[model samples]
Target: MASTSVSKKRKREAGDDAKASFVLSTQPKSQLGPVLANFPSVKPSKSTTFSCYQTGGNAKALGDADDAEFAELPTLIAGETDSVDFHSANQPTGCRYLVGVHDKKTGITTIRPAPVHTLARDVKALKSLEPIAVSVLQRLEARAALGETFGTKKAKLAIKAQERNKVDVSAMETVVDHLQESIQKSTQALPSKEEAQATADSTRLVPPYNAEATVPSEVYPLHNIIPEAEWRTLAATPFLVVGQMQRTPLLPFQRSQWINQHLHSICESSSPSKTNIKILLYISYMMFFRKFAIQSNLGKVVLEEKLASMSPVVADGLLSRFTESARSSSKPQFTSQKETLLLTHMFALCLRVDDYATDTELIARDLSQSTQSINTLFKSMGCQITKLTLTDLKRLGLPDGAAGTKRALLKVPLEFPKPRGKRRRK
Candidate 1:
């Protein structure tokens, strides 16, 4: 019985020594037993080892989410400095903690210990002395998450103010100098207008923005998912190209070039005329700039009124194209390839503009289809129609209160449905 007590006492003393060796460890070594139990067969790699406070079990437990959180933290190997001993290299006695310093001008990140107070400190070193520890970062994350949850204008402003307060006065003192330097660099980097024009003139085989120029879409329109017959019909149909109506056939590439030219022209012109708006351009504008196009009541009214002027045949064509383009690639259907490809590009842009939710009213008007049909088209692309609450609109940077209006927004998922294979015979 006395021998058994001695053995247990020795084991306890060994455990205490192990715990004492780990500095700044929030989690105890005993807690790692469960983590190791989850993967008992797996062993730590011999090449790499636990650095100081890190343990093999704890390292293994850091999944994708935890890795993302620590992705910004820069690493510094022991070999970089000769001051530390190689025999007991796991702990860097000199460096109690490491800090990541980012240079905005050079776009380079460096890992080093926090700056200590010195009389010969430069502006850069003084700025880097701000207390940006892990605890401070965690607090900032928590505050930001809280503001997002509350989602009020005042909450957002308050959070911003709090963040500003966190910055040291020494750091704030250099902000003006940094801003001026960045502005001067940016101005110097821009090429002169005459030089840009000369470069553009010299680079071209044909004139810039040529309607006859073939785009990649002509070769592979939406990966040839749409029917060739429908594509041929679209190619044969007369349409507008660069402000002129063409009776001759316009290939997919020609139409694409025309749209690009029209969009460019719109950017150059302060106010684009209604007469200059082509069917495809109008649809593209509405899809890609939903918030900008329909934020104001006047803009929405004007846009919808423009749709009223569209001929029945043009509207029919729009409906055919949009429906085909929006349809799932998994579903078997006959469609116009050019229209499908064009709308596919527009949909991609729309998805990016609004994150996941897209407005369908503008495109619905272009299609001359009911809201139900538009919703069905979005659903085919694996999207769900979700109504945006007042808070949602506020969070999205819409006008204050937005007159208490609600919109039926389409929620898009990153993943789409995969085509199913036929079952084998029993």
Candidate 2:
């Protein structure tokens, strides 16, 4: 009987040792308690747990409800609070950490911080997940599944792009048609007047001539030919022809004949009732005077001779006709014509008078004639010419006091005294 008791004692000690070993292996490190403690705060109070595998293999505890207390255990166990399964309570799902409690009373199975290696393994697997083309396709498929989200907007954008393309096509057609029409019209147009003139001026013509022709009879007649010695003898009297031409006396008459021809043309073309004859005569006389002025040393001698040679009645009649035209017309038909005539008359008078060198009698006379003509012209216009004073001259682009002085100066004859005898040494 004593041996038997000793054997029971030995058995008891072995059981105790087994319990100690289990406790040591299952005990959580203190560092894990804080981390695990945070889990309870996040645990859903109304969450349900269930053992998906077996019904009776789990114990359901109503969280925060008056439920029967369970005995504590030292070993890890699976339990359910409500329907949530604790079979893998210490394991982490993809997103949450699973925690458990260690019961200290019973040596039977109880929930505690069980092995979390499975939870860690699951988290690691998720971390290794990579995106692929298939993932993008799946996302697009999901978006398409939710068609009401974006499909309508994309369809509208496509419609707008098609409308814009149509507008561009229409505009291009219109532009091409316009360009072709313009090209056709421009090609059919005629050349301009200036272009025709340029073309005509660029053309060249050749004269008809033979390169090798004997002294042509028509060019060098036998009657005009003379011996070389006779020609040399005649060359010594070179001035004979020039002297004869100068002494012909009919040279002036010939020149006057040409002037008369032009004058007749002017008379034939002009109207008698319109004063055109007098106008033409004035132009002719002015032209002759200008030529004579340049040739006679600025109207020194030739102008005097020409004026003296003219019949007094004819000269007076011409002058009186010009003055009458100036008086009858409210407006001078040609101002340049009138000015030319007056200037020529003044030049002629200047050449006629030798006393003009000292005194301005001739100039004064011409000035009086001009003033009277102007006054009559203004009177025809029903305006007083004398009323156009220095003030009016300013309006005509002349300076103040210019009217009187310029008028006075223009009336003076342009003449210089002929030099007397040669100067003697002082």
Candidate 3:
């Protein structure tokens, strides 16, 4: 009966997708209609009923539902964010839309869409109903709550695939167009067949053109050029061209891989002063020598060579100093046992005690000094050791001097030790 009534109505007004009485209009200031004012505080339900619908990406007012008038609404590309599904019997016949809210803390997405018309009419309090708004503010708020993935549809996958396909096809088409253009240009540039044959025939070695007057002598530079013939025949040259650039020796210090990177650039940029380069080379050599001089393995010959590299005068002076002082003598030291004991005592006494008269008889006791040589011992004593000792002072005697405290210093000896032969300076 209902189908017959709808058929009669449609025929009366020229059949339309929706009959006039049932035609939905969202032309008011808000697509949500009077629902906003009616339900100022429409709390969402535990079972989410809304989802966001992305209309053709432009900022078109959804109130212009006429644009999609013939098509069904909410062409849901990807939705299923939750497990709850509505029964088929409860689904709406007209266009449907989505509304959603997001909960950021829980990462939950909730959406509600246009409810069944039967449900809308059955409910007394409209506060239970939530109408879908054209403004995206509701969708934005929902996203903030649930995050984008929880309740949102992935409708963009199909759209992205389409865009990718379009790009590929456009690129292929452009390549084909360019190839066609090049092919056409080449074809137009080609000479006609009759002219091509005549030109080829003219280049051939026929009579009156070369030796048979066929090939022209003037066409080749090698045949008649005197300068080229002279150059080919000449064996010895009189003049020479020398390059102005003289290579600067890159010193070993600057040969490090790290330094090489910048060394050439720095050298090229430097002012043309050979003196400065020489000075820098000498300085690096000296620095290297100074660092290596104390090494035990260094030989005198090598040292001399290094010193001579700097200057002959420097080498001479260095050798003189080496032989006189720094050089170690190979002669074995011969010290009598008593001489050794006496020298040891002298070293210790000098460290702990200050001034005292040198005793010649005591020093000459059993060592090889035919006569007392107290002066030699005194001369070898060096500076008095500043390190003070109680026994040393008592033995030498005194807060006043060592004249009366002999028993106080039995541990220390009074006699000065004999010194060995002096190392004479050259």
lDDT of 3: 0.35
| TM-score for candidate 3, residues paired by index | 0.16
User: Scored by Cα lDDT, where does model 1 land?
Assistant: 0.40
- Per-model TM-score versus the true fold: 0.21, 0.15, 0.16
Between which residue pairs do clashes occur in model 1?
A: none
Distance from true position, residue 315, model 2, in Å? Answer: 7.6
* Residues 71-180 of candidate 3: C-alpha lDDT, one tens digit per residue: 24322211122332221222245555543455544444554444332211122354468986666756644544454345335544544444465545555875897899
> Candidate 2 residues 1-426, lDDT tens each?
455433434345434554521333243332122122223322434454322121243644323232222111111233344334333334333443334444445554433332222211123344468755568747745755555455588865665565465545565886898999999899778678777654543331111112232422122121122223322322212212333343223122224332343334433443322222232233344445434443443322334468553334434433332332346654323234544444434332222221111123223342334555543322221122232366446544555654444222111121212226788999
Please give, for residues 1-426, the per-residue lDDT of candidate 1 as tens digits: 465544444445433333212122233322321110111232223453322122334323322333322312222221111222111212223434444555554444554332111111123334447775678778779879988788699889888887787857676785888989999999997889878755754442211122222431221133132233422322211332343444212321223343444445543456653333333334343343333222432233343454553333433443444333334543222334433344444543343334335566644554445867656545544456666666667666666654343233433222223336899999
Which clashing pairs does model 2 show?
48-83, 48-84, 49-83, 49-84, 50-83, 50-84, 92-119, 101-112
Instruction: Give the distance in Å from residue 333's predicted Cα in candidate 1 to where it truly belongs.
Output: 12
- lDDT agreement with native, every candidate: 0.40, 0.35, 0.35
